[model samples]
Target: MMGLSYFWIDGGTYLGFIVCITLLMFILIMRSFDLKLRRKFTRVAMAMIIALAAGALELGLLAKGDTSTLIYAALLLKYILEGYMEIAVIRIVGRDYKKIQSKLLWIPFIVISILICTAPVNPSVFYFDSTLGLFVRGSLGYSIFIEAGFYLLVGLCICVKKWFTGYQRDALIILFMLAVVSTGVLLEEAYIFDNCTLTSSSIGVLFVYVYMYAERYNVDSVSMCYKRRCFYSDAAKYAKQEMAIISMDLNDLKYINDNYGHQAGDVALLTFAEVCRSVKTNKFILYRTGGDEFMILGIKSSQKEAENLISIIKEKLKETPYTCSFGLHMYKPGEDFEEAVVKADKAMYDDKHIYKSNKNKQANKRDDRFDEKVQSFSNDIDFFDEGE
Candidate 1:
């Protein structure tokens, strides 16, 4: 309080107080929800609270803009919490968030954070403008912004592209939130808005809770698809639309589990899930119905569209140890969804039958060739015994 500006007494203090109170209320509301969701989003709650606290510290800097200690500490907390927020959202959404971890970026981020923290030793990263009575960017200020921009973009890409059950509409919500926060930060940096970025971040984090984490009941944790429950609910709703339902089963899952071990089978299953996710468009939703079986509900879809989606998976078949067989059916309005599903299932079994047949034929052919080679060798030996 001695050196820092009194954020409340200032004209802008009211707005900050309102935003901070909202964040606190949000934390309490989330805690009252399902126990599992509370445990799941604990990191997000912590991160948002830390961000709020940083904003409070930020107000302390208005009085003593020249003192870099409080501001630097605030910034450090903000950056760390930003990372945590992204990771938490991605995790709850069932994305393999670990795939984005980069050992290469870690060193640079650590170095930059350390450099920014030691602001008093040198003023290149940031300095207090006594004339304006505000903290201004030093030489490395732009670099810090760039790094923040990179982090925000990474978070967006992780969630928007790979996670979220209803990715089309849901992913857009995430993208929009990120954009709002980024715009606020940019405006603040340009001195157009006072303390805009921090406020925007608090709002965005709250939205993330409501849109992504709160609605995660449908997301499948193991396969990263929507659960069967999600699929059935949407199927009934989309019955009137020109929908294509795809029934698929992983080929030879039992063989993989027996020969290579269950872990390998899991990898194969996850790999197939990734393939499904890769081919998914905004019009489609994928689900894991059973152990090795999956379904996709595609709006305004056709057999050709379904085949095209399958083709994309075929291209990536080389990347995995397993292959999948599928059947496509166009769901007619007024038709029993279960009947249509049964037909699609029959079609999938036909495909599986063909797959196994081909495999067996190949095996038989190999055996025949082996037998022929052995007979020829025996005849040659008999001729040599007769002294050719």
Candidate 2:
């Protein structure tokens, strides 16, 4: 029998325990965090747990003796578990399984599991070698590579696409780690190594979770503003306080996007976010509540203070070339926060419409002036010619 030291089972077990405890601690501590983030932590943690089991079973697969039915069955089970773990990693990288794209991507991996379940009968992916007394592969053996490399590329694409908004450094590190895991998996496929898959995956997943823990603000990726989820949490936390809501909406954002590009629209949104966040005050909090809309929740007792903050926002916005309209609402004690937000949103739309109409009128007025001046000049030239 092969010695235990060659398998690295001890190291894998220790890493698995560390990852499990870290995830549980984070879940317990971040109870107030958004459900999506918490769910990701839980899923990754559970995947690591299963990975630990799979690693142990792999040790049996490599046992130095005639392969039995039980060992073969364990191999098939490990394949199934690895497929599930892959889906989990994909979800973590994409972060939106409910979306159509995400659903389409992961739904195929189920087919991999189905294929794996049939491995014992067909041995297309893997089977026991009765002659050489080892695990061997069939003609369709590369299905494993097709399944893993596919999602690894997809996940890498997702991570690379989200390289900005505080995830750039994280993405590069994650890419390196995943590359290491991929190399280890490839090595095992060639029968060139053992236990590398579980060890590399555990280390990579642990690093990802640690990075996420350090950056757990529920931050909106595009605008870098506090996300909408935080709005609900904060509202519930401060529901009883007297507060003023300032609803800000970017003017002509659709025009900007349609004219310049979506990138420019993103730039405008980011600019608005920076202006709101940079405003000096601890009593006020900024949120990008919606596309082209933002909110500043002032916790102080005065409506005038809210207005003053809005005024400051306007002044800061003028310094930039972009334009936005804001609505100010003072919430009475015991008033519903949502109701106050609605009022502010309504006021913001009213202001935005007025702003657009005034700009149109100003353009028309300038056009009229140009026409009148041209007419006067033409009349003067005609009179002078007639006199000559």
Candidate 3:
């Protein structure tokens, strides 16, 4: 379009176009599947495609003619999209995707964007060199990479934190993602390779999707907590550690289902799980082992710590309409893990028994009050009849 006789695609543009098309296909396939965080995945994939397309366009323009405003604008858009992808990918780790923390992470991107927008007036962020027909980084040009790296670091930290919480597989998957994207960015930035960033990112997104798809099998769909197999696996993994098992069961789940519907029952389970999560630490891992039954494995915990954990959970449960009964058992260094689980199970059943007994007692008291009021009314009626 710029009227250069030789206008052909370079290696970078070819790779970018290829990666962009692949990402578009990935998005289509991803939409067909029902996955948790599906929207977030789609958003990042779309952003990646856009970024790749912009990068390819800039490369083609650079090949055709001298550097111009259009090329600079394309570069700016690519940077912004890259920054967004970093932040969005990190958000997949937890619930922060739409939270204030995620929004706060955007501040750096906004600042960078404003600086890039004023490049015409001030070339400190980035400028084009017409003499060499090249795009050159200005003083603040490094800011974009620094910003992208900051998000990658944040994502890596979150994954590391989750690793300590017994999410080894999930955390490792995220770490792999960071590694891939970081390598891509390094390759492009260091001139080691051209137009490979988009390809690497696309591969990373695919890996994450595969991991997430596998994760669904190990996760409780309703509560989004680890399932029975994960619990078993983690229990054995932490068997040598000074761990405590906290077994919990929701009270009146059947009642909720019968009276309010199964959907309400699901809400109760989710609520109980959330309460447990709120009180859990890095030393603790929460699992939904069965319907209305959950467990927490607390690493390096004492009986007293388990008690405090239960207490905190109870207080949180009071705010919700549902309640949970808990049983705590500290594992001896060499004790059978299943035996320890059984002990915890027994304790939980005992707690459940107590909870049921107290509930029945309250019900009986209400019934007794009703009977007395009825008797009092009947006696007053007989007295009025005699007086008449």
How does each model score on TM-score?
A: 0.71, 0.55, 0.76
**lDDT by candidate, in order shown:** 0.66, 0.68, 0.74
For residue 236, model 1's alpha carbon misses the true position, in angstroms, by 2.7
- Which of the two, 1 or 3, has more TM-score? 3
- Say which candidate scores most in TM-score: 3
**Candidate 1 lDDT (Cα, 0 to 1):** 0.66
lDDT, candidate 3, 215-328, per-residue tens = 778888677689999888987887778888999999878876886677667767766776676677777888998888899988898888889989999998766666788898
* Number of residue pairs clashing in candidate 2, backbone atoms closer than 3 angstroms, sequence gap of 3 or more or interchain: 0
Model 1 clash tally? 3
| Pick by TM-score: 1 or 2, better one | 1
| Candidate 1 deviant stretches above 4 angstroms | 1-55, 64-99, 129-132, 163-166, 190-195, 255-262, 280-282, 311-315, 356-388
Name the runs in model 3 displaced over 4 angstroms: 1-36, 63-65, 96-107, 153-157, 160-168, 235-244, 257-264, 281-283, 298-308, 319-321, 328-343, 364-388
Give the C-alpha miss distance for residue 156 in model 3, angstroms: 4.5
